[model samples]
Target: MRADARKNYDHLLAVAREVFTEQGADASLRDIARRAEVGLGTLYRHFPTREALLEALLRSSFNALAARADELQTADDSAAALMLWLRETVAFTHENRGVIAPMVSAIEDHDCALHASCVTLRAAGAALLARAQADGNARADLDGSELFDLIAALAWLREQPSHAPRSDRIFGLIADVILVRHPRPEAPNASGHTGRQPKGRS
Candidate 1:
């Protein structure tokens, strides 16, 4: 890329980051171009599509999360490592608001621009979950695809204004359900009852 073209690309990416952070993943591309002081055609020339733009923006963060999973694999407690990775992955989805939809779609669509990154991320979480299950910490029936769905569900809950306050409580509930032996005891619910066991189990 020429110097000027590269400069425009960087500037557009920076502006898009800000816009997406404020308005979410579905924020208008035209707005991003306007904010970056570039023409819409220039933006399209660089990113081609909304998925392409999102892929460029999220590639680094996705890679970092994958790397974090690798590091957590060596942790002494498989359950703790899995929980930590889950928390981080959920938080990432929350941070990149409205991304879960595209991510889920990307995973099922091989030709999608974000498909590879989404697949890699899901695999990372799967590895953590598998390790915990093998250690008898998490439920054996659960799989990586289910884990990814849980992350997306948790993140979606946080996005709701009414459910945001209870997101942490729900997270604890979900975590407790996933782990065979509760890693950390959760406080009593509003009903003054301690955590409930996963359904279908004694």
Candidate 2:
């Protein structure tokens, strides 16, 4: 790609991320172009369709989350690492619920880049889960796709009128189910400071 074309593509992705989060999946491509300060032709040249753009957004977000897992270095406590990733995933999915809903709804009806990106994301998440399981901190039965499916389901649930609180409790439930030992639960002492403290001797 030419310098200007590369610039245009980068601009489109940045602008699209903000617009899609704010306006959901149906945010206008024309608006994206306006925000990128580029022509509609430029946006289309990089992403042929709205789904294509959404897929790119999904891929970018998933890749970012994967990088975060790497940076977390979960070898110390795979459960903690998984919990962190799960929390991030919850936040990410919550913000992108609008983008995901239509793609999920239409998946049975069409071949979509959004679906492909989701498959890839699941594979990535699965890989991380597999590693955690191998470390014996997580259950062997937890497949990556299953965990991702749960996240997607929870995200959809959160989109419902009464399911928003589920978001906070759901990930903890997931961690509880999958981890071999429940993470040291947080406790607030009489001092009013809340965190884990070393066990006192009997």
lDDT by residue for model 2 (1-202), tens? 9998788788899999899878888888899999888889988989998888887778767678767867665457767777777778767877785755654544444576676556655665676787788888788977876787677777777777687876678767767887888457567788977755558933
Q: Could you say which candidate leads in lDDT?
A: 1
lDDT of model 2, residue 85: 78
lDDT, candidate 1, at 169:
96
Q: Tell me how candidate 1 scores on lDDT.
A: 0.94
lDDT of 2: 0.75
**Model 2 ranges with Cα > 4 A deviation:** 2-15, 28-43, 102-111, 114-117, 182-202
lDDT string, candidate 1, 27-116, tens digits: 999999999988999999999989999999999999999999999999999988998999999899999999999999999999999999
Q: Distance from true position, residue 80, model 2, in Å?
A: 1.6
Off by over 4 Å in 1: 182-202
The positional error of residue 147 in candidate 1, measured at the CA in angstroms, is 0.3
Error at 154, model 1, angstroms: 0.3
Local distance difference test, each candidate: 0.94, 0.75
